[model samples]
Target: MRKRLLTEVEGVVAAPVERVWRALLDDRPAYEMTTELGDHTVAYQGGWWYRGEWSVTAHPEGARVVLRVYNVADRLGWGVPLANRFFVGFGARTRQTFAEGLTALGERLGCPSRLLP
Candidate 1:
């Protein structure tokens, strides 16, 4: 039951943290992709192998959003890597998707946003 790290990406929003937080609450992702919601974090646990979590934190410019994927398999955890090997560029694709999401969120919030390196 180890929550192994998979990949992580981050973005910065040029708006108040509260505004960003409220927007996250008002606009959640697809229901099937979500497993937990908290004051500053949203988590998605899919099947028995994958978990993606997003969190927001105060930043000097405004707020910072981070998305982290994990290997949360309850069994056959060793196969997670073997299975993922077939999905080449999975981490890159995940980062790109998260960056696009941040851009879209910025657009919706009428603020500037940029993905972190």
Candidate 2:
């Protein structure tokens, strides 16, 4: 069985959900496993313990983009906490990267984008 340890971040873009979805598809990573949740959501699982999910939904300003990352480790799952503290700033890095992505997406779509609190 795989154990999932989740970290999430979200942002809003001043564009249609379809546009955001298309952009997400264009930049998706190549993963070992894929799950299509719906027209607006997709998930990819790869490596020994990585899964990423992306989704777009309607928001008051425009479209909301959500990104979720999971450590889906089949083995040594319990080591994640130790690794997180000693090896990498996982959550911080994810947030920084996601913020950059949102900025780039906004530039691509000619719309404004911002991370949610």
The TM-score leader among the candidates is 1
Q: Write model 1 residue lDDT over 2-95, tens digit each, in one string.
A: 7999899999999988889888767665557646888799888887789988899999989999899999888899898888889988899998
Where's the lowest-lDDT run of ten residues in candidate 2? 28-37
Which stretches of model 2 miss by more than 4 angstroms? 1-3, 30-37
Tens-digit lDDT track of model 2 for 65-90: 99888887778877766677785788
Each candidate: how many clashes?
0, 0
Indicate the residue-level lDDT of 69 in model 1: 92
Deviation in angstroms for 5 in model 2?
Answer: 3.6
Task: Say which candidate scores most in lDDT.
Answer: 1
Provide TM-scores for the models: 0.91, 0.87
